[model samples]
Target: MTALPPVVDEQTWRDALADLLVREKAATKELDAIAAARRRLPAVKLPEYRLTAEDGSSVTLAEVFDGRSQLVIYHHMWSDGNRWQCSGCTGLTSQWTRTGALAELDARFVVVTNGPMDEILAYKKRVGNEMTWYSSAGSAFGADMDAGPGEGFAFNVFLRDGDDVYRTWHTTSRGAEQFSLFFAISDVLPYGRQEVWQDVPDGWPQDPTYERWLTSKDVAALYGDPEA
Candidate 1:
C-alpha cells in the first residue's frame, strides 16, 4: 500500500494546494492556445478516391460529406482471411456506437477500412454499431493517406466546399489516443492504467497495456448488471 501524506494543519495544506493550482491554471491556458493554433492550420485538397459501402455500392469522397460539409473518417486497422480488425481499433470504433448528435452539429463520422464489404458488415452486426462503414479496398484513398487499413489506424477530418473536398487535419499513433474516453478515465485511477509503461509507486500492480481490454463484460462484472 502507498503511504498517505503527512498530517498537517489546515492552513499549510491549503497553501500547498494553492501552489499546485497556479501551475494547473497555467497549463490550462497553454492548452487553449495550442487548440487555437490547431484551428488555423491550413487544409490541403485531397485526390479523387472512391470507397465501398457494406451494400457493395461505391461512395465518393464528396458523397461522404452526406450534405453535412464536414466529415470525420476513421481509418480502421483491419486484417485479412479469418482475422478481424485490430482489437484496439475495434474497441476504439465501438465507442462511437451513438453518433446521432454529430449529424445535428453538421458533422458526419464514418469508418473506412481496407477490409472487404462483407467482412466489415459482419463485424458491425456482431458489435451492433450504427456508424456508417466503408471499405477502401483497391482504392488509393488508403495509400494516399499513408495509413492503408491494416497498416495503422488513423482519424482524418475533411471539409467540403461546393463540389470539392479538402483534407483539414489528421492524427494517428498516440496522438489519436484522446478519442478513447476509456483511457481518459483510466488516467484518473490510483493504479493509473496499471500499465508497466507508467511510472508508479512501488508495489503497484503492473501489466502491459495490451492485456487490458476493458470489455463490456468487465463493466458488467463491476456493476453486477444482468442486462449488459
Candidate 2:
C-alpha cells in the first residue's frame, strides 16, 4: 500500500498551504515573463514546401494557416507499417480534440505526420480524433522541421505573412508536457502522478514514467465517451 501524507491540524494545514501559495504565485509570474519573452523571439523564413491534405490534395505551407496568421503544428510521430501508434503522441493529440477556442486568437492548430494519408485517416477514425490532421508524405517539411518519419514528436509554431511563412518556435519531449492538462492536475495530487522520477515522500507508490498514459481508445472504453 502507498503511504499517505502526514495528517495535521486544520489550522496547520491552512498555514502550510498559505506558504505554498506564495511560491505558486511566484512561479506563475515567472511563467508570464517567459511568455512575454517568447513573443519577442525572432522567427526564420522557411522555404516553400508542399504538404498532403486530408483528401490527398497538395497544399503549400502558407496555405496550411487556413487564412490565420499564426499556426501551431504538433508533429505527430508515425512509423510506416506499424500497427500500434505512439501512445504518448496519441494521448497528447487527444487533449486538443477541439481547437475552436484557439481560432479566436487568430491561430490554428493541426497535426502533421509522416504517415500516408490513407493510413492516417484510418487511425484518426479508429481513435475518434476530431482535430484537423495532415500528412507530410513525399515532402521535406517533416525532416526540415526535425520531425522526420519514424522520428520523435515535436511542437512547432509558425507565423504566416500573406503568402510567406516563417518558423517561430519549436520544442519536443518534456517541452510539450506544458500543454497537457493531465500532468498539471496530477502535480497537485497526493502521490503526484505516482512516477518514479518525482521527488515524493518515502513509501509513496511510484511506477515507470508514462506508464499511466491512457490512449483515446482506453478512455472511450473506460469512460464510455468516445470523441468520434
Candidate 3:
C-alpha cells in the first residue's frame, strides 16, 4: 500500500490556509468586476404605473424617484389577502442598508408590493427597517417586473431621462449565497448567524432562520430573558 504524506504542523497548516484565502480574494474581485459591467449596461424602459406609500399617499413611477435620474424598485413579494409579508422579500429588506446618500447619486430606492400600505408599514416596523416602503396593491407593477406570484425572484433598475424611463438591470439568485456584507463576514468568521438554524460551534445555539425571525410574534418573549 502507498504511504500517505506526513501531517503538516500548525504553522504550515496556517500558511497553507492563508494562501488559499489570498486566491479566494482575487477570485472575488473578478466577480465584483463582472457585476460592475452589468451595472454599466443601458437601462430598459418600463411602463408608467402608480403605487401607494405607507401613509396612503399615491405616487406614479416618476413621482417615486422624486425627480431623480435613477430608481431602484425592490418588488417585494407581498401580495393581497393571504400572501402578505413574504419571507424572501423580508430577507432581502433585512439585508439592505439605508442609502442616506442616494440623493447625491441621483437615485432613489423603494420597495414596491401588492399589500396595502398598512400591511407594508407593519412589516417594516416589525423588521426595524427604515427604508422607504410602498404598495402597488391595486396595480400590475409587480407583475410587470416579474415579481408576481409564481414568478421567479427578480429586482430591476430603471433610468430616467426627461419623461422616459428605461429598464437598466435586474437579478435573482439564491438569497443566502448572494454576496453582501452579511455573507462576507460569515464566510470568514467562525460563527456567522444567517438563515436561522445555521449550525454553530459547540455550546452555541443555532440561529433562527430569517423567516421565523421576522414572523414569530413571541420572538421577544422567547429570546428576551436577559438572564437566560
Strongest candidate by lDDT: 2
Error of 3 at 148 (Å): 1.3
How well is each residue in 94-120 modelled by candidate 2, as lDDT tens digits? Answer: 777668888899999999999999988
The CA root-mean-square deviation of candidate 3, after full C-alpha superposition on the true structure, stands at 6.8
TM-scores for candidates 1 onward, in order: 0.84, 0.93, 0.72
lDDT of each: 0.78, 0.87, 0.67
Q: Quote the positional error of residue 94 for candidate 1 in Å.
A: 1.6
- Over the full model, what C-alpha lDDT does candidate 1 score relative to the true structure? 0.78
The residue-by-residue lDDT of candidate 3 on 1-228, one tens digit each, is 432334799999889889999999999999899889977896667788888977798877777888899887777665555423455556556667668688899999877776788766665655555578878777888778777754655677888877677888776665424525556666575445544456544554344465334342332133222122
User: Backbone clashes in each candidate structure, one number apiece?
Assistant: 0, 0, 9
lDDT: worst 10-residue window of model 1:
219-228
* Quality of model 2 by C-alpha lDDT: 0.87
Residue 13 deviation, candidate 2, in Å?
Answer: 0.8
Candidate 3's displacement at residue 107, Å, is: 2.1
